[model samples]
Target: MTDALLPNILQFIGQIDPFDKIPKNALRTLATQVQITYLGKGEVIDLCTAEQEKSLYIVRTGSMEQRKVDGVLRAKLGPDDMFGFSVLGKDASSDKGYRAIAIEDSLVYIIPQTALQTLFSAHPDCAEHFASQAQVRLKSALDVVWSNKEKGLFIRTVGEVASGRVAVVTADQTIQAVAHEMRMVQRSSCAVIYDNDTIVGLITDRDMTKRVIAHGVAIDRPISDVMTHSPLTIKPDDLVLHAASVMMQFNIRNLPVVEDNKVVGLLTTTHLVQNHRVQAIFLIEKIKYAGSIKSLASFTPERQAIFEALVDGRVAPEVIGKVMTMIMDAYTRRLIQIAIDKLGPPPCNFSWIVAGSHARNEVHMLSDQDSAIVLSDSATDNDRIYFNHLAMIVTNGLASCDYPLCPGKYMAATPKWCQPVRVWKEYYKKWVSNPEYERLLNISVFLEIRTIYGNSEYETTLRDALHSNIRNNREFLSTLVNDAITTNPPLGIFNNLVLEKSGENKKTLNVKKYAINLIIDLARIYGLAVECDLSATDERFKAANSQNALSDDAFKNITGAYQFILSLRFSHQLEALKQGQKPDNNINPDSFGSFERKHLKDAFRIVADLQEAAKVRFGSR
Candidate 1:
């Protein structure tokens, strides 16, 4: 390899496994021995031939297809896919006649047997990796990709990538002082204005131009006069997506990150654009103003692309769910707004409520409609007619835009679900007072709700009332826990993924039904039992754990399982999209490489332990 490309190659190989396990100096030496080659279409290399058998090939670009002696295709390999599995064959003189041919113009790197042997002797793990059977080799390779991404991306929290030590100024400081500070720093374009250590405002250079310079306002005036008061803020622990959303929502270029009543740092558009490749942020803006059902429907491909980006970025499932939820939030609100425009304003104050995955903000690619209308107490028959028509329009529009209609008729388009706040409370009253099996199903769905549109007070009053009832009503919570445990996580005694052996989903795990729903049920039970308002699964577990409603280990096991199951589901959907298929919940265990197979077993074990813990906690309640 040329020295110009050697550093890049060495850095890449250093991250991938077998190479990663080897020392840097050894990798540098191996980098020198690498021979890069280009091939045109139909260029064949006989891997089984004695002359080529001793060389290992890695496809750096384009595709190479391997075939058996009879010309039946064995596999198609692309960038980063390793081949020449028999490079260290015991019988070097034998020819097996299986050959790999470049199906397109290709670029590949070859490592000769001599250099490989030297490196292998120094690092036995590298040798063992290459010598392993195909199954084992497949696993190690995947593990390499995953481990490198883990160490590289670290997509957990804003704190992971945020800059430290934000600049702060007092609210009473003069605009002149703020402008001077902005100029002095030169590099940083913004500053947070604080009062008693609480983030009161933020001032960016743009603000200085639009508010002060343009208006020719006296620069000697207090910074509060020109600063953006009560600016939208984020936490250091918040996801970078949150910061991006705040910036997008408020149409501001910077946000003051507050943690524990202190400004921790400033997050700028520059940071987000430089660091994250998330497209969902851009997608949200488009949905907000999309007026027609046809325009909204056109984003189906971009919606899929959003999922693909999150999956490829190795973002955590919880964050992925929230980002997707944020996108749907845009869709839901815009639909409601469009509906309102067409149907005229509502007859009374109301809140558009979204429940289930949408409510919990744990949405995946297949998130369907789960919504209701909570009208004001003064609503009448005319109001009912107005809302019923409105729900039909909005729900239908959502369906057209890839949000399928709710299967159980749970959507607000149904007249019964479109009701006044008082009537809604009555429904909760009856459901809680008598938790019959059917009513329990509704309770499970309704318990987690997010008010996407209209008067926030309506949902707040209803949720407060619900929480109040759940606080002392042990019977209601008992029934909830009982319902939560009705379907235990589908795991066999041997800790294998227990899939349906018969029926349409035969030989596949219904990840949504068994793994995802089970976690949701537990979170609902624990959250309601503890009277915690949070509906997100991870937050519910955290709240319960902090309150000692769950043991430390129980909390860890359950939340860990939740994350893993959701991650698997996202990956599955992404895989489906790549294959030009519709994404769904069913996953075949065989589809997973051994890396996922091992984690799947461990995740299921955690699920089992979680079920046991939930059972014990509610056995007497």
Candidate 2:
């Protein structure tokens, strides 16, 4: 190793964790074994064929792409990222051949497996840091793949696996008779069928107790009287999770598995629940128990587990939002608590306000954390001083937890964000009454706020003031509508998705910015105009369903568009996570299959239609 390279390596290590406590001689030993190499763009620095000599390579500049045996490019790695630790002593001919190719001219430092092990033995923190970063990237990409697989619409047919023996009853059967039969079969539910096996209805334990027994309906009457007619049925070939969704949505315990329009088998909530990957539930529980920052940081693995389950669970969009929000809120609150502890107790009570996805309780895997602070006005000078310090500590603590600081300086630590409740109300009133560009943008972010920690009364007051101002302001509503419509979705000439055109992200489509947020903005405006208290975009749309503010056609169009965009974003983020890269919304459209491209086009069309409708509604105002 060159003398200059040693200092650079030491400096990099210092940035991660200072090596001041290590013996000088041991540091020298580390410096001696390190090797540096320069790679030009498109160079293959490490191939599966070089599996005999395992080494960890850290990027100093530029990026690398990892690929599988089928030549499908998997992930892109950037500066300060490490890879190749998993290839040690593995046979080259094994199925797990991974290749790394440079994306641009770059410098990489290599550490042999033996040296890394030795270094870890002495400086465990360094090794843990590297491992944590690698795990985050890998888990993120895997999450994408898992989510896509779960959301894919290909239905599985029941005829393919039907055993031909299924519990069934005729509509003429009495509830008591069916209940007795169900108990005899050791099943909680059964399907009602006609003479030729056509599924006419279904009944479950809840149906028996709630509809028949509770109503004092004669149990001797036909089961059809108590059974749900035309119950939601799924084809056997449909995905198992699709049936699970039907169960969850209708609060039913059973589904009739149909094939060729005939009942072939029965599916129960227990089947769905049992098949669910328990790891996800475990992860959610662990996150709930994470009472400290250090404990929360250990949840990366748990987060990965949840990501994987979400993909595999194929949960409904609403449920997905709930699950993601739980983890995101827990992590954010834990980080804030850490910061508070670091800064000592606050001199006065304050509310930690989460904005954006976190605030709406609809956070996805790739979403960034956005938050603020609303201090109680009863604070003394000492309280202000203590809170300001606490805010910075909280912000930095979140950054360490993989939530990078907001590039727009909207974070809680910013002086503009950390304010008393009175200041926040004034900010809201000014934005609502006078719709300036910057003010409107700020208002959009603020609309999603939720109280994460501390006294929530301050948040309640601020929300009430915002709603009160918007309720009577027709002109302000129209201006907001115009602003919402201005996003225009991502539609291009001939109704194509307009992909990004600059820098390393060229040819990628920003699903979150161009597609999802467009729907969110429109929903926000509609909700505000109608005085809907819902915060989640989907919930807002549902709340506006009855109002003439949005026509039925427009509501359906926007809802479908939002779901399609969210599914795409979820898939992209999961893929990025699995590939050991940062989960993001920049997805290359060309990478999608023909069916996905078709759906994406349809989603964009829906957005465009909604935008046109908004323009028409507001232009006259």
Candidate 3:
């Protein structure tokens, strides 16, 4: 390339990832070695040639398509998109008849293997982008988003933040001895009681005041007498967000960090309070004590604030989903309690369950209510009336707290969803046996159910019945697989542009309908085919992989794609919220910069490939 054109080449690649990650001086040198070439619309390049030297190709001016030996489409590439990655790394695998064909008269840039190696030598961080494994490349893409992040509470493990000032005592130790040890050793507020080598119990300062002093118990008694037996613990490797969840769920102020069955350190409310960023982690505690619906509704702003902090902290998308879901759970459970107080206790045993996104623990800013109730079989018609009133109160209260009512009435407040346990089992039996496309909309929402309050066994019984019915009906999965693949990802997103210029969805893309939900549907099919009971999308994919339902490479690529797309959706929603707009799933292509647009194409391609594979696998069964 002439030196005059080098600056233009530098500018084009500079805005794209991995190249953007390269140092400016090194990138200028890389640009100098680029070879510009052109291809006619029908021309093809043999990517797996035995005689040709290996090289990387980047489209500069027009579009192209890659294909395998049998002419199956591999990917669609547009300007700034890359190919020839299969031949870049040390463990580069054979393309096995894979080739690139220009769909338009194209201008392309070729980087010789030697020139690429020279760049990698100076900037090793950029080399992972060319890695043969899809997971490595996907991870490198995600890393670019957090490249500016300084390691903070969201990224640090529990071990990194926990205090090592835990007071360890034997189960046989006297209560007075344990208290003295706590005071003498850093004034630790909690003690872990061990029986020989095993952890037996945990005691807190409150236990001393209430169980000892308040009860007039002798101080010489064994500490086990007052300690909380089989207290919940967290692993050192766990994220602090997880520990925060455990503490909020159980209403504990202190938590022991245990690894290998040995207490190593302690995490307490004081430790969490030091980081203002974690204030949202403890917001659930406040939700627990809110006096009424109006007070609970006031926490909506704080919920948005928590989401902003989590995203700004660069927390993983799945973890962010979980944190948001826990807050929703807190709101639901608290609202139920408030309803009970107003309407009096239920006349019979029942379970208030959540379905769809809530059950999946995948709740986000745009998520609304998808819930139901399971009543005991012995309930009378009068009992039904009472439960119906309670459901109505909780559902409307959730809407007051910023969670919108389900547009389809798929809530506990809906008469059809509030049923006796046996009736729920009957619903599952009918859905699995028929698997009709018309009933799919309703069936899909309740496919994953979880109990949030009341009798837990009712939820378990429903799940067992559902799974049993699915296992016996082979054609059910085939029908689901067919439905899942009907909406292919927008692979032409890059070539034709990322948005529709006309129609009801003009100037925007419905990412939830076209991309995210497609992956969720596929995961559900795979999960059900293998009898996997997990509700979360990522976990269901993982469970499917373990059971050999999906190959290792397929599993990693699909899950990574799902995570990337979800993160983008969350980011889009956050930006809308910041701009004082109502959050929704419609994303404008014009909003995406070069960096996001490029990776989104890659993620879309991955989902498309997996969908094709699913059609072949389950369509035959």
Candidate 4:
């Protein structure tokens, strides 16, 4: 290759996979040994039988697919995706052969076996990424993409940043003694109350102030009298981001860090504020106290900034979704309070529950309002009026904050969705017992539900009813599998990508519909088949794995596929937001370079494989 083109090739390789792990000077040397060649759309490279020198074939641009000798599709390739790893090993045999076909006009980079072996000798660790197994390489690529030198503040684990000097006191100790212990520790905003070698309660400074001084209670009384019983605690390994959410959700300032049911340290608001690199915690605080919808709406810029920061931080997609969901919950709760102030206290007890992405805790920048209100059975017609009005204000208020309304009118503002507990139970029964295709589409969104506000028992009651009905309904899961398999990943003949034939999104792929949703549907189907009530996609798969419905490898591959595809969608959205354009799921095919295209193809293939598995698993019924 010419010197000028060599630099370009090095730049491309430097940003991708196992190559990214190589040292700079070594990468340039390796780049020098690469020979660039072009192949026409219908050309084929004989990987085993050809008399040419053995080499690693990396696609620099365009696309290709590998097929077994019997013509079964081995894998689809895009830019930065490499083949010929098998031949690089000393034990490779011609009997285990596959051929690469240029499904699209392609530019291929050929690295002679001698050069790669030499490079591997110098950078021994890099060899693992070139394992013949596609799973290993894909995992290596993920590790490279996720690892960072300067980690974000919230991404750190609680144990890494929390103070180890905790004040542990017996429940029988007097409040005066506990305060003395707190003073001695020098790290105490809260003290863990232990009894018989078990954590039984917790007491903070606020407890001393309110329960002792303000109430004129005797300080000589046992701390257990005022301590919070069975206090909520976070594990040492959980992210500080999650700790922050827990604090915000319950409106507490102190959280004891526990592991194996033993107190290790404490995470407080002080620690969170001290390490703040982003405004997520602050924005959530603002959302909580903001009295006016206009004030809440004005924080949209700050909200977007948090999203951008989380994406750039390379935090796990599930963690990012949780952080985003907490913020949304804050907004929703505040709006409900504002409505209550204007319309008077609620006429009856109710629970404001969310569905779909919101319920699954997988929300993103594009997530809309998928919620409903479950009223007390005692609610009257007058009560419905009050709630409908309340729902309108909250939904519109969410819109002003840039969370658009659900296009299908799934929000609580719709009377059909805002119903009493009995009606909600009936809806689940009819949908599960006699699912029609039209109702199947609607029920899929509500299959995962969570209560964010009001009487949580209402949610528990509804969930139990739904799960019971689902377990008794034999044909329900198969129906869901049938619907889910109807929309396959956009993989076509010769493993070429299928794109939108025409329209505004022409030549674009809907990653959500074609890839992410397919995995989610499979998780839900498998999750429910075993009576697993968890809402999150990853958790559902874990439940399936634990139940022996999915093998360990299948579970990991499918979940990894989900995370990779979701991250790509998030990156695509971030790009649009930076360009001052609206973000949607339809991603332009041309926008993906070889790196994204290759991994995306891998992710798509994983989803398609699981879809077939689901068909055999459930469709046989």
List ranges where model 2 is wrong by over 4 Å: 1-277, 284-292, 340-344, 492-497
Per-candidate TM vs. native? 0.71, 0.55, 0.88, 0.84
How does candidate 1 score on lDDT?
0.76
- Cα lDDT of model 3 by residue, 188-295, tens digit: 999999999988899988889999999999999999898999988998987787788778778788989999988889998788778536665668878988999999
Return the clash pairs for model 4, or none.
79-594
Clash count, predicted structure 3: 0
Give the residue spans of candidate 1 off by over 4 A: 1-157, 160-198, 213-226, 312-314, 346-348, 493-498, 589-598
Q: What does candidate 2 score on TM? A: 0.55
Q: State the lDDT of candidate 2 residue by residue for 1-621, as single tens digits.
A: 767768778766433222343556776687678788899988896456654477877777777766665675444555555566446433323436567788789888787878867977887644533342222322232333335444422222333333344557788877778888777774545645554566677777777778877889997998877777777777775555445444543567666777677666877656544545444344545554566766666777667667655745655455566666666666666666666667778878899888887777676665665788898878776777787788787777666666667777787888888888888999999998997889987887888778878888888888888889987676776887777666666533111236676888877777777788888888887787677766888778877777778766567657766666676677677777788887888878667653354345446656766666676766625
RMSD of each candidate? 14.1, 19.3, 3.5, 4.6
How far off is residue 432 in model 3, in Å?
A: 1.8
* Candidate 3: segments with Cα more than 4 A from true spot: 1-7, 94-97, 147-159, 163-202, 205-230, 233-239, 245-249, 256-265, 274-277, 495-498, 529-531, 616-621
Say what the RMSD of model 2 is: 19.3
Candidate 4 error regions (>4 Å): 1-74, 77-81, 84-118, 133-135, 167-189, 194-200, 213-220, 245-251, 259-262, 313-315, 492-496, 619-621
User: Candidate 4 has what TM-score?
Assistant: 0.84
Residue 72 error, candidate 1, Å: 51
Q: Is candidate 1 or candidate 4 better by lDDT?
A: 4
Q: Which one is best on TM-score?
A: 3
Candidate 1 vs candidate 2, TM-score winner: 1
lDDT of 1 by residue, 469-541 (tens): 7765767766766666667665331113367779877788888887788778778888887777778888888
